[model samples]
Target: MIADIDGNASVSNATGKPLTKRGEATRTRLLEAAEVVFAEQGYHEASIVKITERAGIGLGTFYLYFDSKQSIFEALVIDLNRRVRHSMAEAMAGTSDRIAAERAGFAGFFRFTAQHPALYRVVREAEFVSPEVLKLHYTRIVEGYEAGLARAKESGDIDRRLDPEVTAWALMGMGELIGMRFLLWERDENGLPPAQLDERVFTAMTQMIDNALAPRREGNHDD
Candidate 1:
């Protein structure tokens, strides 16, 4: 499970109570089931029965935590939001430079995408199922990215001219689209997405980010 900045266990139930080991496992199972079902069926067609069935739980068990289909879907989105952020944070940790952090962060994102292909599809459904949840998904990502970029700029790690919030959104847009095209769409002979980013493409993309975000040199004339 993910944790707060203070390092406390972050797993909780619908009542906001810290979960027992068993409760945490159950919630995780339901969310994982929802991920697969939502990605396969989309929100409009995916029902609570399907989620519970996939989760191998009875109908009554679902209501113990979530009230309805919409509730679970929203919860799923929130859960995914936490998870992806953690993935990015963990990857960027201890990297030597801002560009290195960016490359590592995007690598984490694509790794999650390859394993949980449901990410793109479920987030897209949030546009109709719950617009606020869609915004929540994006804003959470931007919050982390903006904070990191702000620090990097202050430390002379990245271009000071770049606005942290704007740069965050731009970099997020780049990562999502790249994951969609290269990771989601690329398939092997067995019709499965590759488990890693292509090395050449990763290097090229990181070079572009380095150029865009690198601090301007004193002798530089190009805008």
Candidate 2:
């Protein structure tokens, strides 16, 4: 991550500016608080005061990191987007095959979603508040996914006929909806989403993915 000396509320991706350990900690706190405030109050209702209170920081300190409500909101989205992708990438890292990688990636996604329900809310709100950032989120994920899928296709890891771009988007959409249903909407007695997807459900979803992306043979029913 880089820094913007120009004083953006959040960190920038371009410059290689480094923050002190305390500065990084403070920034993390602000983003976390913003997550809770946005999830509970929605973008329009959330205020700087509320975020600072939730973060246990002062108004002046908030300015040091972020300039306004929107800036912080955008930062929050970026933070969530980066973390979720990291989770997926890390999970997929050691997988031995394309199918395993996909399954692991989705598992990571759901895990992050369950742990951070605010992700869904903040992203949806970005459509209205910051559509560009919203696009950045999906496009960034798809770029990395397309690269991996392209490599897998070249190596016969997945169906050679599959278009990497289309497949990447389709898989992402599938994961999003499935996560929304199983990880976000499905709740326990206390009304909290499960920390992990059920084993049975996970198996069912992975089976479907395997069948969908696996290459076809002459005797296959789809043929």
Candidate 3:
């Protein structure tokens, strides 16, 4: 990772010049290092020095691209979100079926989280502590789900009787909570083998969605 000599919040190069190929490479290194640092150590605990060291850059160089460790962490989060949004867009664009889109999108998310468990932990944990980040992340995801739910309802895949916004929120919350429970919260005893996380999460999520979408009993007020 090439460290920018100038302390600026832009992802520029070491010379404090425009972002060339080398500059972009340096920026990528910084973001990648930030991801690892934030994942291994919580945001508050991570240091700019550590991040720079991880990126193989000097502390001054670190400052050139990011004002502080917080900025770098935010950049990492933004990058992750961008990747997720891109993946979802690709899945949706490729398919006309809502169910297929949801399944593919969720599977992509699951795979991404599985591969970057540490980074996911950093972002997930940061949400409550960082309202700005939370809002940004939630808005992107919620909008996507709402749009998806609308499509599903139109296609007769989802129950049009239900409020699409509310239903989408419920489904999103379920998937997130379940992912956290099975992926983030797993200790030694609770941890499934790495290979099983995807299948287990998918099965659990599918079952939960199925149960929620099933017709309620006459006396049941439960969702």
- The lDDT leader among the candidates is 2
How displaced is residue 183 in candidate 3, in Å? Answer: 2.6
Q: Which stretches of candidate 3 lie over 4 Å from their true place?
A: 1-18, 90-93, 186-201, 210-223
Tens-digit lDDT track of model 1 for 57-172: 98887876677788788888888877888888899899998889998999999888888788888898889888888888899899889999999999999988899999999999
Q: Find the number of clashing residue pairs for candidate 1.
A: 0
Model 1 steric clash pairs:
none
TM-score of 1: 0.91
lDDT of 2 by residue, 115-176 (tens): 99999999999999988788878887898899999999899888888999999999999989
Give the lDDT of residue 176 in candidate 3: 73
Clashes by residue pair, model 3: 6-64
Q: In what order do the candidates fall by lDDT, top score first?
A: 2, 1, 3
Alpha-carbon runs more than 4 Å astray in model 2: 1-18, 217-221
Worst 10 residues of 2 by lDDT: 1-10
For residues 72-109, could you state the per-residue lDDT of candidate 3 as single tens digits?
76667767776666665765677656666666666666
- Provide the global lDDT of candidate 2 against the true structure: 0.85
Number of backbone-clashing residue pairs for each candidate, in the order shown: 0, 2, 1
